[model samples]
Target: MSLHEILFIVFSTVVLLFSLMTVLSRRILRSATYLLLVLVATAGIYLWLQYEFMAAVQVALYAGGIVVIIVFSILLTHHIHHRSKPFPPVRVITGLGVAGLGAALTIWAILQHDFHYHEAEPLEVNAKVIGQHLVNTGDGGYALPFEVISVLLLAVLVGAIVVAKKDKANEQTSENK
Candidate 1:
């Protein structure tokens, strides 16, 4: 009916389709690309909610940064299973059962609760307030989480380096053999 409603429908459909594709596709590269599409569709939904900053962050971080890194990791690691051994049967069944249980729990919780919306005061997204919050000593400050995230990034970088080196070593050993 409305543009917003149409956008919501489109984004929701795209996300669902891409997510299904991400799971169903056998190829690692294709699955990664589909997952990227799903993230982009989620970003579009964030934009529809008027969270432009969050939407941009989702696209840049998930699609551009994380997804690229993931694809690269897959390429470099080369641990992707071929069609003959896509996954172990027991692991696949366990994952599906867990996923089904989680879905059932979420649906039950939704059915049990009656949710109502209340409009809250919007926070200012100005640079000055954001800067203060980023480095402030108060409860509203996000400095701790920000610092922790930097540590996480460093860990990820180190892990990526280790994985890459391991892959290279395996390749060299196989070649030598």
Candidate 2:
């Protein structure tokens, strides 16, 4: 096998394994760490595919930004070492069923696609074009999605703060009582 194939296998394996660990881990911090690993592995795959800008975005946005926020939220909860309760059998079964269905659908879609490999010149990377595409309101622009993601992150931050504050208030009230 070629080196590219070997690297792809390794990176894909890391992504899959860490993703499974993220879902199955009992400790909240451990789960977050596993998710970070998964994101980093996904970035590696993007890099391998020669999408340097996409790989950087994956690393910077998802891995660096989101994962850091998640870790901070977990730390703010003061439950760094807390373990989540084990999933019930029914929940486990349902999760597995849904995952299997998604995987089957994805495989079927891939099989239906015509991915004829062609050796073409790489597209030139231009910062100005990329920036315009990111913020443009015209066709093929990503402005809407970017705004949505920003809003989602804001919501997560607000929710984390509310939860942390509520927990502290409950603790103080119980102590006074």
Candidate 3:
């Protein structure tokens, strides 16, 4: 097999393994870490596919920035280590059944389509072209999304800090009393 094919296989395997671990892990922190691994592996796949810009965005935004923020927020909470165990099995089984059915439907749809089975167009890798298309989308300028994303992240940061501080304040007041 070619080097690209080998790397692709490895990336896919790692992504799948970590994704499963993310779902199956009992510890919240461990599950978040596994989720980080999955995101990083997905970025690797984007890199292997020669989407350098997309790969960098995946690493910077999802893997590095977003995951760190989420993990830290959980860590910063009041004794997340003592979080109650996950809920009972009825809802869990229902959710899993829905997920399995969705996956099967998605697979069936893919089988019915001519998706990637034939190469109709060549993929390009130029920042200039992408930037132009992003702005030309009229309604969805890429720059607009970037600003929106920043605002959303900022909101998450502020919300997490407020929650952490509230618990700290409550603890102090109770201790004083």
Each model's TM-score?
0.80, 0.87, 0.77
Error of 2 at 2 (Å): 0.8
lDDT winner, 1 or 2: 2
Q: By TM-score, highest first, what's the ranking?
A: 2, 1, 3
In order, what lDDT does every prediction score? 0.84, 0.89, 0.82
Model 1 lDDT tens row, 36-113: 999999999999998897788688767887778777777777756634347888989998999999999999999999
Best by lDDT: 2
Tens digits of per-residue lDDT for model 2, 80-138? 98989998999999999999999999999999999999999865669988888889978
- Candidate 3 lDDT over 59-170, as tens digits, reads 8888888788877877777465754578689989998999999999999998999746555587584988777867763653577767777897898788778877888889
Error of 2 at 31 (Å): 0.7
Worst 10 residues of 1 by lDDT: 76-85
